[model samples]
Target: MTARPPTVRERRLAGELRRLRESTTALNLEEAAEGLGWSKTKLSRIENAIRKVTAAEVQQMLALYSVTGPRLDALVRFSRTTRQRGWWDVYENSLPTDYATYMGLEAESEWLNSYTMGLVHGLMQTEDYTHHVARSILMRFSPASEVERRVAARMARQRAWTERADPTRLWTILDETALQRVIGGPEVMRAQCRRIIELTEQPNVMFQIMPLAAGGHPGVVGSFAILGFPERFTPNVVYVENMTSALYVEDEREVHTYALAFEQMAAMALSPEESVAMLERLARQ
Candidate 1:
């Protein structure tokens, strides 16, 4: 028997609702159930993501709980977004649950703020370059076929704003060392730079380079992506990607910290014009 796939969006909604419920003075599940006109079991299902939560219902509960103003609006919006389906859904089984959640956020984000130390950030990588990077991991996992499929899915997920009329605006600050570091060698590096140049030309895209000379920045720790959704429905999320897994943080304080860190990274990065010149410099080398 096949194990049931993780319901990423459903789980996210359920978790968010649960957190909201916890923060309120519900006093008892029975009281909360009567207030929302839901049975205890139904409430439990929504909280567990075993059942989908309706945005209207969520808003109603928030209103009843006195969760007002912008935060209430944000939670309402999040409930609606749980219905957002992305292309990455096909590979749900191939990637880990957290990775899948990250992909969905990346796809829907209107503005993406990313910082990569020296390695390739998934969104900025060329297809073959990604293969070279992912190939290294294939050796560790079972089922060679599953590995290939995931690589292809990863590559597919990376295709952002290639054709969108108003594609996501990507504001990226990559270490200058990243330009010098050849991942798959000269050819791959050249193509990657060319791709960067192409992506930067998009009206919504912004690519900046943080030179070695601009030392001691927030991103010195690792990579982080701050995703701003289009509809302004949810709180901004910070995605921290590691070798093994990724972390999505949405706590107000944590998000604020990452936002400030991204701003500092941007200040340390080269100006847009200078960044383009640096890309050209890399491509010519």
Candidate 2:
């Protein structure tokens, strides 16, 4: 009885549909609805991604907007995936809406560019580190079981880089403080460092350390990640998180700002070989 929340695919399809209608037809909402012989509310809901659209419906709308050729075929093909459920769907009820949405996007991303100021990225975290981090922040307000659920979800998220047949390419620039701050204690940090070192050996993984000597840089403000997808229609998303909630930046200019910042930080950070040496040295200490 409740409307389903839009998945990343649905949101992409909806945005494209709205763009086409506005740019091509140049019709106002009421007029568009009248032309489609549908109630204004129905069109509104579809455009807002509150309702699922059928492939047939997509064709009809494309026809109305005078869309033809490859773009039309692509949209119709994309519409079929709008209703497909992701593995993360099972944990949706337990996870925050924004976090769940992030998981969905991460799973489908072809590559990731991450800059971390205080901790290891979730996709690269060891189970012990994940448990410690989850409990430290969540235990004050969340029940132990809920905390465990979150931990499980995080661990599952690692599959994007680990278990997949074609693993997502990951490039992370970690602040030196993140390496120095012993998360779960000496032993845990050692194991975590070892884990990171091992992952860096993989062809798809790239790790860099922004040494303390770097002094000041654009990333000094905070940490963020940019998710790039294989398809052009599904634009890159920049994810920024704080203590309680997260923000997804999709505007071209805003995402470009984050991307540029990441590139600048990457230049300031240690090279991949040097970073692995630093990890190995830390693991010993």
State every prediction's TM-score relative to the real structure: 0.83, 0.91
Clashing residue pairs, candidate 2?
none
lDDT of 1 by residue, 1-285 (tens): 114543556556676667667766654666788888889988887777777667888887787677889878877777776655668788777777778778776777788888988666677788877776777666656676766776787778766455556677888888888777767789899888888888887788788889899968888888888988765435577888777777778787999999998887888789999998988887888
What's model 1's overall lDDT? 0.76
Clash count for each candidate, listed in order shown? 0, 0
Which candidate number has the best TM-score? 2
Local error of candidate 1 at 255, Å? 0.4
lDDT of predicted model 2:
0.88
Candidate lDDT (C-alpha), each: 0.76, 0.88
Q: Ten residues in a row with the worst lDDT in model 1?
A: 1-10
Off by over 4 Å in 1: 1-12, 22-45, 67-84, 139-144
Tell me the spans in candidate 2 whose CA falls farther than 4 Å from its real position: 19-35, 63-67
* Candidate 2 local lDDT, 245-273, one digit each (tens): 99878777889999899998999999999
